[model samples]
Target chain A: MTDEAVPSWEEVAHRYGRTIYNFAYRLTGHRDDALDLSQEVLLRVRKGLRSYQPGSFEGWLWRITRNAFIDETRRRKRRPTVPLPDDDRSPLGVAPGADEALAAMRLDDDIQAALLALPIEFREAVVLCDVVGLTYDEIAAAAGVPVGTVRSRIHRGRSMMRARLS
Target chain B: MTHPGDLLSALLDGELTPEEIGAVSEHLDMCAACRAELEATAAARTALRSLPVLDPPPGLLPGTAPVPRRRMLRPVWGWVAAGAAALALSMGLVLGTAAGPAPMNLDGFSEQHTARILVQPGVQAVRAVVEAP
Candidate 1:
Protein backbone atom coordinates (compact mmCIF):
# COMPACT_ATOMS: atom_id res chain seq x y z
CA MET A 1 0.00 0.00 0.00
CA THR A 2 1.12 3.56 -0.70
CA ASP A 3 2.11 5.66 2.30
CA GLU A 4 -1.19 7.50 2.12
CA ALA A 5 -3.15 4.28 1.81
CA VAL A 6 -1.48 2.80 4.86
CA PRO A 7 -3.31 3.46 8.09
CA SER A 8 -2.16 6.47 10.06
CA TRP A 9 0.10 5.73 13.00
CA GLU A 10 -2.70 6.53 15.41
CA GLU A 11 -5.07 4.17 13.64
CA VAL A 12 -2.45 1.49 13.41
CA ALA A 13 -1.77 1.96 17.09
CA HIS A 14 -5.42 1.58 17.84
CA ARG A 15 -5.74 -1.52 15.69
CA TYR A 16 -2.48 -3.40 16.14
CA GLY A 17 -1.02 -1.96 19.33
CA ARG A 18 -2.34 -4.71 21.50
CA THR A 19 -1.09 -7.37 19.09
CA ILE A 20 2.42 -6.00 18.97
CA TYR A 21 2.45 -5.41 22.71
CA ASN A 22 1.34 -8.95 23.43
CA PHE A 23 3.94 -10.37 21.06
CA ALA A 24 6.63 -8.41 22.84
CA TYR A 25 5.28 -9.33 26.27
CA ARG A 26 5.27 -13.04 25.45
CA LEU A 27 8.76 -12.76 24.05
CA THR A 28 10.09 -10.80 27.03
CA GLY A 29 7.82 -11.99 29.86
CA HIS A 30 8.09 -8.48 31.31
CA ARG A 31 5.42 -5.85 30.86
CA ASP A 32 7.60 -2.75 31.18
CA ASP A 33 10.30 -4.11 28.91
CA ALA A 34 7.66 -5.30 26.46
CA LEU A 35 6.10 -1.84 26.37
CA ASP A 36 9.46 -0.22 25.78
CA LEU A 37 10.38 -2.76 23.14
CA SER A 38 7.03 -2.47 21.35
CA GLN A 39 7.24 1.33 21.34
CA GLU A 40 10.72 1.20 19.92
CA VAL A 41 9.59 -1.25 17.23
CA LEU A 42 6.70 0.98 16.20
CA LEU A 43 8.99 3.98 16.14
CA ARG A 44 11.36 2.19 13.82
CA VAL A 45 8.47 1.05 11.63
CA ARG A 46 7.29 4.64 11.32
CA LYS A 47 10.73 5.97 10.40
CA GLY A 48 11.40 3.09 8.03
CA LEU A 49 8.01 3.01 6.32
CA ARG A 50 9.16 4.86 3.24
CA SER A 51 11.78 2.22 2.63
CA TYR A 52 9.34 -0.64 3.08
CA GLN A 53 8.42 -2.11 -0.29
CA PRO A 54 4.82 -2.87 -1.20
CA GLY A 55 4.19 -6.42 -0.02
CA SER A 56 3.34 -8.39 3.10
CA PHE A 57 3.06 -5.46 5.48
CA GLU A 58 2.58 -7.82 8.37
CA GLY A 59 5.77 -9.64 7.52
CA TRP A 60 7.70 -6.39 7.25
CA LEU A 61 6.23 -5.18 10.52
CA TRP A 62 7.07 -8.46 12.20
CA ARG A 63 10.66 -8.22 10.98
CA ILE A 64 10.98 -4.81 12.55
CA THR A 65 9.38 -6.10 15.76
CA ARG A 66 11.75 -9.05 15.89
CA ASN A 67 14.81 -6.88 15.36
CA ALA A 68 13.66 -4.44 17.99
CA PHE A 69 13.33 -7.24 20.52
CA ILE A 70 16.78 -8.57 19.68
CA ASP A 71 18.32 -5.12 20.05
CA GLU A 72 16.65 -4.61 23.42
CA THR A 73 17.86 -8.00 24.59
CA ARG A 74 21.41 -7.06 23.64
CA ARG A 75 21.16 -3.71 25.41
CA ARG A 76 19.82 -5.38 28.53
CA LYS A 77 22.78 -7.72 28.51
CA ARG A 78 25.28 -4.84 28.80
CA ARG A 79 23.35 -3.07 31.55
CA PRO A 80 23.10 -4.15 35.17
CA THR A 81 20.35 -6.69 35.64
CA VAL A 82 17.20 -5.56 37.42
CA PRO A 83 14.78 -8.43 37.67
CA LEU A 84 11.24 -7.71 36.54
CA PRO A 85 8.67 -8.65 39.14
CA ASP A 86 6.16 -11.30 38.16
CA ASP A 87 2.78 -9.88 37.16
CA ASP A 88 1.17 -12.77 35.33
CA ARG A 89 -2.18 -11.26 34.53
CA SER A 90 -3.31 -12.68 31.22
CA PRO A 91 -5.49 -10.07 29.55
CA LEU A 92 -7.37 -12.96 27.94
CA GLY A 93 -7.94 -14.99 31.05
CA VAL A 94 -8.63 -18.69 30.83
CA ALA A 95 -12.17 -18.85 29.46
CA PRO A 96 -14.88 -21.43 29.80
CA GLY A 97 -14.39 -24.35 27.41
CA ALA A 98 -10.85 -23.01 26.79
CA ASP A 99 -9.33 -26.15 28.18
CA GLU A 100 -11.50 -28.36 26.03
CA ALA A 101 -11.13 -26.15 22.98
CA LEU A 102 -7.39 -25.99 23.48
CA ALA A 103 -7.31 -29.72 24.05
CA ALA A 104 -9.04 -30.31 20.75
CA MET A 105 -6.70 -27.79 19.14
CA ARG A 106 -3.70 -28.79 21.31
CA LEU A 107 -2.82 -25.57 23.20
CA ASP A 108 -2.38 -25.99 26.92
CA ASP A 109 -0.53 -24.23 29.72
CA ASP A 110 2.07 -26.99 29.70
CA ILE A 111 2.82 -26.32 26.05
CA GLN A 112 3.20 -22.61 26.70
CA ALA A 113 5.44 -23.25 29.67
CA ALA A 114 7.47 -25.68 27.58
CA LEU A 115 7.78 -23.05 24.86
CA LEU A 116 9.01 -20.50 27.39
CA ALA A 117 11.62 -22.93 28.59
CA LEU A 118 13.22 -23.33 25.16
CA PRO A 119 16.37 -21.36 24.31
CA ILE A 120 15.73 -17.94 22.78
CA GLU A 121 16.58 -19.17 19.30
CA PHE A 122 14.30 -22.19 19.54
CA ARG A 123 11.60 -20.23 21.35
CA GLU A 124 11.55 -17.58 18.64
CA ALA A 125 11.34 -20.22 15.94
CA VAL A 126 8.43 -21.96 17.66
CA VAL A 127 6.64 -18.69 18.33
CA LEU A 128 6.94 -17.53 14.76
CA CYS A 129 6.18 -20.87 13.23
CA ASP A 130 3.43 -22.14 15.53
CA VAL A 131 2.03 -19.11 17.33
CA VAL A 132 2.47 -16.41 14.70
CA GLY A 133 1.70 -18.78 11.82
CA LEU A 134 4.45 -17.42 9.64
CA THR A 135 5.86 -19.44 6.76
CA TYR A 136 9.37 -20.73 7.12
CA ASP A 137 10.61 -18.23 4.54
CA GLU A 138 8.88 -15.35 6.28
CA ILE A 139 10.31 -16.41 9.61
CA ALA A 140 13.77 -16.64 8.05
CA ALA A 141 13.51 -13.16 6.60
CA ALA A 142 12.23 -11.76 9.89
CA ALA A 143 14.93 -13.61 11.79
CA GLY A 144 17.67 -12.73 9.22
CA VAL A 145 18.59 -16.34 8.76
CA PRO A 146 18.38 -18.92 6.01
CA VAL A 147 15.14 -20.83 5.44
CA GLY A 148 16.92 -24.08 6.19
CA THR A 149 18.01 -22.69 9.54
CA VAL A 150 14.46 -21.67 10.27
CA ARG A 151 13.15 -25.11 9.42
CA SER A 152 15.81 -26.84 11.46
CA ARG A 153 15.31 -24.56 14.41
CA ILE A 154 11.56 -24.99 14.29
CA HIS A 155 11.99 -28.76 13.98
CA ARG A 156 14.41 -28.97 16.89
CA GLY A 157 12.34 -26.50 18.89
CA ARG A 158 9.10 -28.40 18.37
CA SER A 159 10.87 -31.62 19.18
CA MET A 160 12.19 -30.14 22.40
CA MET A 161 8.78 -28.75 23.31
CA ARG A 162 7.17 -32.14 22.70
CA ALA A 163 9.79 -33.83 24.82
CA ARG A 164 9.17 -31.34 27.61
CA LEU A 165 5.40 -31.65 27.45
CA SER A 166 5.51 -35.41 27.30
CA MET B 1 9.94 -49.24 11.55
CA THR B 2 10.33 -45.94 9.70
CA HIS B 3 12.15 -43.20 11.65
CA PRO B 4 9.07 -41.05 12.21
CA GLY B 5 11.13 -38.47 14.09
CA ASP B 6 12.62 -37.24 10.82
CA LEU B 7 9.52 -37.59 8.66
CA LEU B 8 7.08 -36.35 11.30
CA SER B 9 9.05 -33.14 11.84
CA ALA B 10 9.25 -32.58 8.10
CA LEU B 11 5.54 -33.29 7.66
CA LEU B 12 4.52 -31.04 10.58
CA ASP B 13 6.62 -28.24 9.13
CA GLY B 14 5.14 -28.74 5.60
CA GLU B 15 8.67 -29.22 4.32
CA LEU B 16 7.96 -32.59 2.72
CA THR B 17 7.79 -32.87 -1.06
CA PRO B 18 4.76 -34.62 -2.62
CA GLU B 19 6.93 -37.64 -3.32
CA GLU B 20 8.25 -37.65 0.26
CA ILE B 21 4.67 -37.45 1.51
CA GLY B 22 3.73 -40.50 -0.55
CA ALA B 23 6.75 -42.35 0.74
CA VAL B 24 5.94 -41.35 4.33
CA SER B 25 2.37 -42.52 3.96
CA GLU B 26 3.50 -45.90 2.70
CA HIS B 27 5.97 -46.22 5.57
CA LEU B 28 3.35 -45.20 8.12
CA ASP B 29 1.17 -48.16 7.03
CA MET B 30 3.88 -50.62 8.07
CA CYS B 31 5.37 -48.74 11.06
CA ALA B 32 3.43 -48.24 14.27
CA ALA B 33 6.38 -46.25 15.68
CA CYS B 34 6.23 -43.73 12.83
CA ARG B 35 2.44 -43.55 13.17
CA ALA B 36 2.71 -42.80 16.87
CA GLU B 37 5.30 -40.10 16.22
CA LEU B 38 3.08 -38.51 13.59
CA GLU B 39 0.13 -38.55 15.98
CA ALA B 40 2.16 -36.94 18.77
CA THR B 41 3.51 -34.20 16.52
CA ALA B 42 0.01 -33.51 15.23
CA ALA B 43 -1.36 -33.33 18.73
CA ALA B 44 1.44 -30.98 19.80
CA ARG B 45 1.02 -28.66 16.81
CA THR B 46 -2.74 -28.60 17.29
CA ALA B 47 -2.16 -27.67 20.93
CA LEU B 48 0.26 -24.95 19.88
CA ARG B 49 -2.38 -23.43 17.58
CA SER B 50 -4.86 -23.24 20.42
CA LEU B 51 -2.62 -20.81 22.28
CA PRO B 52 -4.61 -17.65 22.71
CA VAL B 53 -3.19 -14.74 20.77
CA LEU B 54 -1.95 -12.74 23.71
CA ASP B 55 -2.86 -9.06 23.86
CA PRO B 56 0.29 -7.08 24.26
CA PRO B 57 0.41 -4.42 26.94
CA PRO B 58 -1.36 -1.18 25.98
CA GLY B 59 -0.02 1.22 23.33
CA LEU B 60 2.12 -0.90 21.06
CA LEU B 61 1.28 -0.29 17.42
CA PRO B 62 3.12 0.73 14.24
CA GLY B 63 1.45 4.11 14.06
CA THR B 64 1.38 4.90 17.74
CA ALA B 65 2.84 8.24 18.66
CA PRO B 66 6.56 7.56 18.96
CA VAL B 67 8.53 8.34 22.07
CA PRO B 68 8.23 11.97 20.97
CA ARG B 69 10.90 12.85 18.41
CA ARG B 70 11.48 15.95 20.53
CA ARG B 71 12.36 13.78 23.50
CA MET B 72 14.99 11.91 21.47
CA LEU B 73 16.34 15.17 20.06
CA ARG B 74 16.91 16.65 23.53
CA PRO B 75 20.15 14.74 24.12
CA VAL B 76 21.43 15.79 20.70
CA TRP B 77 20.78 19.42 21.49
CA GLY B 78 22.48 19.08 24.84
CA TRP B 79 25.60 17.74 23.15
CA VAL B 80 25.52 20.58 20.62
CA ALA B 81 25.21 23.14 23.41
CA ALA B 82 28.11 21.62 25.36
CA GLY B 83 30.27 21.61 22.22
CA ALA B 84 29.39 25.21 21.50
CA ALA B 85 30.34 26.26 25.05
CA ALA B 86 33.70 24.50 24.77
CA LEU B 87 34.40 26.24 21.45
CA ALA B 88 33.50 29.62 22.90
CA LEU B 89 35.81 29.09 25.90
CA SER B 90 38.72 28.04 23.65
CA MET B 91 38.26 31.08 21.44
CA GLY B 92 38.13 33.34 24.48
CA LEU B 93 41.45 31.91 25.72
CA VAL B 94 43.15 32.49 22.35
CA LEU B 95 41.81 36.02 22.04
CA GLY B 96 42.63 37.02 25.65
CA THR B 97 46.29 35.83 25.43
CA ALA B 98 46.79 37.73 22.16
CA ALA B 99 45.44 40.98 23.67
CA GLY B 100 47.55 40.94 26.87
CA PRO B 101 51.29 40.93 28.05
CA ALA B 102 54.72 40.27 26.44
CA PRO B 103 56.60 37.20 27.69
CA MET B 104 59.94 37.56 29.55
CA ASN B 105 62.54 34.79 30.06
CA LEU B 106 62.09 34.35 33.87
CA ASP B 107 61.52 30.87 35.46
CA GLY B 108 58.65 31.73 37.83
CA PHE B 109 57.11 34.22 35.37
CA SER B 110 57.07 31.56 32.63
CA GLU B 111 55.35 29.02 34.89
CA GLN B 112 52.96 31.47 36.54
CA HIS B 113 52.28 33.24 33.25
CA THR B 114 51.53 29.92 31.53
CA ALA B 115 49.05 29.12 34.33
CA ARG B 116 47.58 32.62 34.16
CA ILE B 117 47.27 32.46 30.37
CA LEU B 118 45.46 29.15 30.65
CA VAL B 119 42.94 30.70 33.04
CA GLN B 120 42.44 33.83 30.93
CA PRO B 121 40.21 34.03 27.88
CA GLY B 122 41.90 35.01 24.54
CA VAL B 123 45.35 33.83 25.67
CA GLN B 124 46.10 32.00 22.39
CA ALA B 125 46.87 35.26 20.52
CA VAL B 126 49.89 35.73 22.85
CA ARG B 127 51.18 32.18 22.15
CA ALA B 128 53.22 33.22 19.07
CA VAL B 129 55.10 36.04 20.84
CA VAL B 130 55.65 33.91 23.96
CA GLU B 131 57.32 31.21 21.89
CA ALA B 132 59.46 33.56 19.69
CA PRO B 133 63.28 33.25 20.01
Candidate 2:
Protein backbone atom coordinates (compact mmCIF):
# COMPACT_ATOMS: atom_id res chain seq x y z
CA MET A 1 0.00 0.00 0.00
CA THR A 2 1.12 3.58 -0.69
CA ASP A 3 2.37 5.72 2.19
CA GLU A 4 -0.75 7.84 1.84
CA ALA A 5 -3.14 4.92 2.39
CA VAL A 6 -1.01 3.77 5.34
CA PRO A 7 -1.95 6.75 7.50
CA SER A 8 -5.63 5.97 7.38
CA TRP A 9 -5.00 2.57 8.93
CA GLU A 10 -2.45 4.05 11.30
CA GLU A 11 -4.94 6.68 12.37
CA VAL A 12 -7.51 4.09 13.32
CA ALA A 13 -4.85 1.89 14.85
CA HIS A 14 -3.33 4.75 16.76
CA ARG A 15 -6.72 5.75 18.06
CA TYR A 16 -7.46 2.33 19.53
CA GLY A 17 -4.32 0.18 19.40
CA ARG A 18 -3.06 1.03 22.90
CA THR A 19 -6.54 0.82 24.32
CA ILE A 20 -6.93 -2.68 22.90
CA TYR A 21 -3.41 -3.64 23.88
CA ASN A 22 -3.91 -2.49 27.46
CA PHE A 23 -7.29 -4.15 27.61
CA ALA A 24 -5.75 -7.38 26.40
CA TYR A 25 -2.87 -7.04 28.83
CA ARG A 26 -5.28 -6.50 31.67
CA LEU A 27 -7.24 -9.58 30.67
CA THR A 28 -4.31 -11.88 29.89
CA GLY A 29 -1.73 -10.38 32.29
CA HIS A 30 1.02 -10.85 29.73
CA ARG A 31 2.57 -8.17 27.57
CA ASP A 32 3.34 -10.60 24.76
CA ASP A 33 -0.17 -12.00 24.82
CA ALA A 34 -1.58 -8.51 24.86
CA LEU A 35 0.56 -7.57 21.86
CA ASP A 36 -0.66 -10.60 19.98
CA LEU A 37 -4.24 -9.88 20.91
CA SER A 38 -3.95 -6.21 19.99
CA GLN A 39 -2.35 -7.01 16.64
CA GLU A 40 -5.03 -9.57 15.83
CA VAL A 41 -7.79 -7.18 16.82
CA LEU A 42 -6.29 -4.36 14.74
CA LEU A 43 -5.88 -6.67 11.77
CA ARG A 44 -9.51 -7.68 12.12
CA VAL A 45 -10.47 -4.01 12.46
CA ARG A 46 -8.61 -3.27 9.25
CA LYS A 47 -10.55 -5.97 7.44
CA GLY A 48 -13.87 -5.34 9.21
CA LEU A 49 -14.14 -1.56 9.09
CA ARG A 50 -16.38 -1.59 6.00
CA SER A 51 -18.88 -3.71 7.89
CA TYR A 52 -18.66 -1.56 11.03
CA GLN A 53 -21.86 0.31 11.71
CA PRO A 54 -21.81 4.03 12.25
CA GLY A 55 -21.82 5.42 15.81
CA SER A 56 -20.04 3.82 18.81
CA PHE A 57 -16.65 3.27 17.23
CA GLU A 58 -15.03 2.63 20.62
CA GLY A 59 -17.58 0.01 21.40
CA TRP A 60 -17.02 -1.65 18.05
CA LEU A 61 -13.24 -1.58 18.42
CA TRP A 62 -13.40 -2.95 21.96
CA ARG A 63 -15.77 -5.68 20.93
CA ILE A 64 -13.19 -6.79 18.39
CA THR A 65 -10.51 -6.73 21.09
CA ARG A 66 -12.70 -8.73 23.41
CA ASN A 67 -13.32 -11.37 20.75
CA ALA A 68 -9.65 -11.67 19.94
CA PHE A 69 -8.79 -12.09 23.62
CA ILE A 70 -11.48 -14.71 24.01
CA ASP A 71 -10.23 -16.56 20.95
CA GLU A 72 -6.70 -16.57 22.35
CA THR A 73 -7.99 -17.74 25.70
CA ARG A 74 -9.79 -20.65 24.05
CA ARG A 75 -6.78 -21.60 21.99
CA ARG A 76 -4.59 -21.60 25.07
CA LYS A 77 -7.10 -23.88 26.72
CA ARG A 78 -6.84 -26.43 23.88
CA ARG A 79 -3.08 -26.56 23.96
CA PRO A 80 -1.87 -25.52 27.37
CA THR A 81 1.02 -23.07 27.12
CA VAL A 82 3.34 -21.53 29.65
CA PRO A 83 1.44 -19.72 32.36
CA LEU A 84 1.22 -15.94 32.12
CA PRO A 85 2.65 -13.78 34.87
CA ASP A 86 0.36 -12.66 37.66
CA ASP A 87 1.35 -9.00 37.43
CA ASP A 88 0.32 -7.07 34.33
CA ARG A 89 2.58 -4.53 32.63
CA SER A 90 -0.01 -1.85 31.86
CA PRO A 91 0.51 1.70 33.17
CA LEU A 92 -2.41 1.99 35.63
CA GLY A 93 -2.22 5.31 37.49
CA VAL A 94 -4.04 7.09 40.33
CA ALA A 95 -5.74 10.53 40.20
CA PRO A 96 -2.49 12.16 41.38
CA GLY A 97 -2.81 12.59 45.11
CA ALA A 98 0.66 14.09 45.60
CA ASP A 99 1.19 13.17 49.26
CA GLU A 100 -0.54 9.80 48.79
CA ALA A 101 1.16 8.90 45.53
CA LEU A 102 3.24 6.09 46.99
CA ALA A 103 0.27 4.54 48.80
CA ALA A 104 -1.89 5.00 45.73
CA MET A 105 0.72 3.31 43.61
CA ARG A 106 0.80 0.31 45.92
CA LEU A 107 -2.98 0.19 45.97
CA ASP A 108 -3.01 0.45 42.20
CA ASP A 109 -0.70 -2.50 41.84
CA ASP A 110 -2.69 -4.50 44.37
CA ILE A 111 -5.94 -3.66 42.62
CA GLN A 112 -4.56 -4.52 39.22
CA ALA A 113 -3.44 -7.87 40.51
CA ALA A 114 -6.78 -8.44 42.23
CA LEU A 115 -8.59 -7.51 39.05
CA LEU A 116 -6.86 -10.30 37.22
CA ALA A 117 -8.01 -12.69 39.90
CA LEU A 118 -11.67 -12.15 39.14
CA PRO A 119 -13.40 -14.58 36.82
CA ILE A 120 -13.04 -13.74 33.17
CA GLU A 121 -16.62 -12.51 32.81
CA PHE A 122 -16.52 -10.21 35.79
CA ARG A 123 -13.04 -9.05 34.87
CA GLU A 124 -14.25 -8.30 31.35
CA ALA A 125 -17.12 -6.15 32.57
CA VAL A 126 -15.08 -4.26 35.13
CA VAL A 127 -12.27 -3.62 32.66
CA LEU A 128 -14.72 -2.34 30.07
CA CYS A 129 -16.46 -0.02 32.50
CA ASP A 130 -13.79 1.28 34.88
CA VAL A 131 -10.76 1.08 32.59
CA VAL A 132 -12.16 1.52 29.11
CA GLY A 133 -14.77 4.00 30.36
CA LEU A 134 -17.63 2.49 28.39
CA THR A 135 -21.19 3.13 29.44
CA TYR A 136 -23.54 0.37 30.49
CA ASP A 137 -25.32 0.24 27.15
CA GLU A 138 -22.06 0.24 25.23
CA ILE A 139 -20.64 -2.49 27.44
CA ALA A 140 -23.81 -4.49 26.95
CA ALA A 141 -23.25 -4.24 23.23
CA ALA A 142 -19.60 -5.33 23.41
CA ALA A 143 -20.31 -8.06 25.96
CA GLY A 144 -23.49 -9.31 24.26
CA VAL A 145 -25.32 -9.21 27.57
CA PRO A 146 -28.17 -7.16 28.92
CA VAL A 147 -27.31 -3.72 30.28
CA GLY A 148 -28.60 -4.87 33.62
CA THR A 149 -26.17 -7.74 33.40
CA VAL A 150 -23.40 -5.29 32.71
CA ARG A 151 -24.41 -3.22 35.70
CA SER A 152 -24.63 -6.24 37.90
CA ARG A 153 -21.28 -7.50 36.73
CA ILE A 154 -19.59 -4.17 37.29
CA HIS A 155 -21.11 -3.81 40.71
CA ARG A 156 -20.17 -7.30 41.67
CA GLY A 157 -16.76 -6.87 40.14
CA ARG A 158 -16.17 -3.74 42.18
CA SER A 159 -17.38 -5.50 45.28
CA MET A 160 -14.84 -8.22 44.60
CA MET A 161 -12.11 -5.68 44.22
CA ARG A 162 -13.14 -4.09 47.48
CA ALA A 163 -12.97 -7.43 49.17
CA ARG A 164 -9.46 -7.83 47.84
CA LEU A 165 -8.46 -4.38 49.00
CA SER A 166 -9.79 -5.04 52.48
CA MET B 1 -33.31 6.54 51.73
CA THR B 2 -32.93 3.36 53.74
CA HIS B 3 -29.41 2.42 52.52
CA PRO B 4 -27.04 3.78 49.87
CA GLY B 5 -25.41 0.41 49.12
CA ASP B 6 -27.41 -0.43 46.01
CA LEU B 7 -28.00 3.14 44.94
CA LEU B 8 -24.41 4.19 45.53
CA SER B 9 -23.16 2.32 42.45
CA ALA B 10 -25.68 3.90 40.10
CA LEU B 11 -25.13 7.17 41.92
CA LEU B 12 -21.39 6.88 41.33
CA ASP B 13 -22.13 6.26 37.68
CA GLY B 14 -24.67 9.14 37.64
CA GLU B 15 -27.23 6.67 36.37
CA LEU B 16 -29.75 7.28 39.10
CA THR B 17 -32.95 9.24 38.40
CA PRO B 18 -33.23 12.69 39.95
CA GLU B 19 -35.57 11.41 42.64
CA GLU B 20 -33.26 8.47 43.35
CA ILE B 21 -30.38 10.88 43.33
CA GLY B 22 -32.11 13.05 45.92
CA ALA B 23 -32.75 10.02 48.07
CA VAL B 24 -29.15 8.85 47.64
CA SER B 25 -27.92 12.32 48.43
CA GLU B 26 -29.99 12.33 51.57
CA HIS B 27 -28.56 8.96 52.60
CA LEU B 28 -25.03 9.98 51.84
CA ASP B 29 -25.57 13.00 54.02
CA MET B 30 -26.46 10.83 57.05
CA CYS B 31 -24.96 7.39 56.40
CA ALA B 32 -21.20 7.04 56.82
CA ALA B 33 -21.09 3.35 55.79
CA CYS B 34 -22.73 3.99 52.45
CA ARG B 35 -20.50 7.00 51.98
CA ALA B 36 -17.45 4.85 52.56
CA GLU B 37 -18.71 2.22 50.18
CA LEU B 38 -19.34 4.86 47.53
CA GLU B 39 -15.82 6.15 47.97
CA ALA B 40 -14.53 2.59 47.80
CA THR B 41 -16.29 1.80 44.56
CA ALA B 42 -15.21 5.10 43.12
CA ALA B 43 -11.69 4.32 44.25
CA ALA B 44 -11.85 0.98 42.52
CA ARG B 45 -12.98 2.60 39.32
CA THR B 46 -10.23 5.18 39.61
CA ALA B 47 -7.57 2.61 40.31
CA LEU B 48 -8.69 0.61 37.29
CA ARG B 49 -8.46 3.65 35.09
CA SER B 50 -5.11 4.53 36.57
CA LEU B 51 -3.74 1.09 35.92
CA PRO B 52 -0.91 1.80 33.53
CA VAL B 53 -1.52 1.42 29.82
CA LEU B 54 1.58 -0.27 28.48
CA ASP B 55 3.12 1.00 25.29
CA PRO B 56 2.93 -1.65 22.60
CA PRO B 57 6.06 -2.93 20.89
CA PRO B 58 7.12 -1.17 17.68
CA GLY B 59 5.91 -2.22 14.22
CA LEU B 60 2.66 -3.75 15.44
CA LEU B 61 1.10 -2.44 12.28
CA PRO B 62 3.35 -3.90 9.60
CA GLY B 63 1.12 -3.52 6.57
CA THR B 64 -0.21 -0.55 4.67
CA ALA B 65 -3.22 1.04 6.33
CA PRO B 66 -6.42 -0.85 5.86
CA VAL B 67 -7.13 0.26 2.28
CA PRO B 68 -9.30 -2.62 1.17
CA ARG B 69 -12.69 -3.32 2.61
CA ARG B 70 -13.39 -7.00 2.89
CA ARG B 71 -16.44 -8.72 4.28
CA MET B 72 -16.16 -9.33 8.00
CA LEU B 73 -15.95 -13.05 8.34
CA ARG B 74 -17.20 -14.30 11.64
CA PRO B 75 -14.74 -16.50 13.52
CA VAL B 76 -17.16 -19.39 13.12
CA TRP B 77 -16.86 -19.08 9.35
CA GLY B 78 -13.05 -19.39 9.45
CA TRP B 79 -12.92 -23.18 9.30
CA VAL B 80 -15.72 -23.22 6.76
CA ALA B 81 -13.61 -20.87 4.67
CA ALA B 82 -10.52 -23.04 5.02
CA GLY B 83 -12.51 -26.17 4.25
CA ALA B 84 -14.06 -24.52 1.21
CA ALA B 85 -10.61 -23.43 -0.03
CA ALA B 86 -9.25 -26.91 0.50
CA LEU B 87 -12.17 -28.45 -1.41
CA ALA B 88 -11.65 -26.04 -4.28
CA LEU B 89 -7.95 -26.74 -4.39
CA SER B 90 -8.55 -30.49 -4.30
CA MET B 91 -11.05 -30.29 -7.14
CA GLY B 92 -8.73 -28.12 -9.18
CA LEU B 93 -5.81 -30.50 -8.75
CA VAL B 94 -7.87 -33.58 -9.61
CA LEU B 95 -9.41 -31.98 -12.66
CA GLY B 96 -6.10 -30.48 -13.79
CA THR B 97 -4.04 -33.66 -13.56
CA ALA B 98 -6.57 -36.43 -14.39
CA ALA B 99 -8.05 -35.01 -17.61
CA GLY B 100 -6.73 -33.97 -21.06
CA PRO B 101 -8.01 -31.75 -23.87
CA ALA B 102 -11.08 -32.90 -25.82
CA PRO B 103 -10.57 -34.72 -29.16
CA MET B 104 -11.36 -32.80 -32.35
CA ASN B 105 -13.16 -35.73 -34.13
CA LEU B 106 -14.13 -38.03 -31.26
CA ASP B 107 -17.80 -37.54 -32.22
CA GLY B 108 -17.22 -39.39 -35.47
CA PHE B 109 -16.13 -42.57 -33.67
CA SER B 110 -18.45 -45.33 -32.33
CA GLU B 111 -19.23 -45.28 -28.61
CA GLN B 112 -16.68 -48.10 -28.00
CA HIS B 113 -14.02 -46.31 -29.97
CA THR B 114 -14.84 -43.07 -28.21
CA ALA B 115 -14.54 -44.74 -24.82
CA ARG B 116 -11.37 -46.55 -25.87
CA ILE B 117 -9.90 -43.45 -27.41
CA LEU B 118 -10.30 -41.65 -24.08
CA VAL B 119 -7.60 -43.89 -22.54
CA GLN B 120 -3.94 -42.81 -22.97
CA PRO B 121 -2.93 -45.73 -25.34
CA GLY B 122 -6.09 -45.29 -27.43
CA VAL B 123 -5.50 -41.56 -27.43
CA GLN B 124 -2.04 -42.22 -28.98
CA ALA B 125 -3.63 -44.39 -31.70
CA VAL B 126 -6.28 -41.75 -32.33
CA ARG B 127 -3.58 -39.12 -32.46
CA ALA B 128 -1.70 -41.17 -35.03
CA VAL B 129 -4.85 -41.56 -37.17
CA VAL B 130 -5.72 -37.88 -36.82
CA GLU B 131 -2.18 -36.86 -37.70
CA ALA B 132 -2.08 -39.24 -40.63
CA PRO B 133 -5.44 -38.06 -41.93
- Which 10 successive residues of model 1 chain B have the least lDDT summed? B65-74
Candidate 2 lDDT by residue in tens digits, B1-133: 5775655667788777899898889878888888888888887777777775576666665543444553333345644654675697678853433468444443323433434445668678889999994
lDDT of candidate 2 at residue B82, scale 0 to 100: 48
Name the best candidate (by lDDT).
2
Q: Please list the C-alpha lDDT of all candidates, in the order they appear.
A: 0.70, 0.72
Backbone clashes in model 2, listed as residue pairs:
A90-B52, A91-B51, A91-B52, A91-B53, A92-B50, A92-B51, A92-B52, A93-B50, A93-B51
lDDT, model 1, position A151:
70
Misplaced by over 4 Å in model 2 are A1-8, A53-55, A84-107, B1-6, B29-32, B61-133
- Fnat for candidate 1 (0 to 1): 0.54
lDDT of 1 by residue, B10-44 (tens): 68778788998888888898988778777777776
- TM-score per model (chain B): 0.43, 0.40
- Report how far residue B102 has shifted in candidate 1, in Å: 97
DockQ of 2: 0.27
lDDT of 1 by residue, A122-150 (tens): 78877777777788888888998987788
Q: Highest TM-score: give the candidate number.
A: 2
